[model samples]
Target: MAATLDGLITFFASHHAIRADKVLRDAGFATELASGPKELSPNCGTALRFELSRTDDALAVLADRHVQVDEVHPYVPRTDAWDRSGSPVRRAKRLWGRRS
Candidate 1:
């Protein structure tokens, strides 16, 4: 079964982000590679989107593999059409926990 996209994982480097994508996918977690939102993460330009509900399992998998993550966030992208008259709105809530 495919996992829902509701969480974002930030990395200190693109290398780690890419590796995370592979690790998560291999561990039966769904993931998507997206440009890291500068407002949320300035450490890297790449971020991995994954299932929020399975965050614990996902993090464990990465930790077991010795992969490091800068931060994890609960992200809900704006779905409405952008208004040229104003700045685009983004929804990202930081999740504080053990970082690995």
Candidate 2:
């Protein structure tokens, strides 16, 4: 896991995440695709992680491509799968809907 996610880009649909991933990667920004945290947005199943250092540049690129983001967050996942006591990070409660 990354020590820190410079920035998070949430989208209303996975399509936006996919497009953003390509654009950000092509622009030389470190990016990753991950399951969207429900605490964040309720729309898409995937989200984008970008270098926080280039947040402004990332936003600008998204705007240039006419991509819409639901929200942006600063996130960093636990580096190790197991904790000191061999426990995993607590999973957030999931919300059920007609879709899944």
In terms of TM-score, which candidate is strongest? 1
Estimate candidate 1's RMSD in Å: 10.4
lDDT per residue for candidate 1 within 1-100, as digits (tens), equals 5567999999999999999999888987889999887767888999999988888999999999999999999865744432332224321111223334
| lDDT tens readout by residue for model 2, 23-91 | 888987789998887667889889998777778899999999888888888865645553453234432
How close to the true structure is residue 55 of candidate 2, measured as C-alpha lDDT? 82
| Range of the 10 consecutive residues with the lowest summed lDDT in candidate 1 | 89-98
lDDT of 2 at 81: 55
TM-score per prediction, in order, is 0.76, 0.70
Per-candidate total of colliding backbone pairs: 0, 1
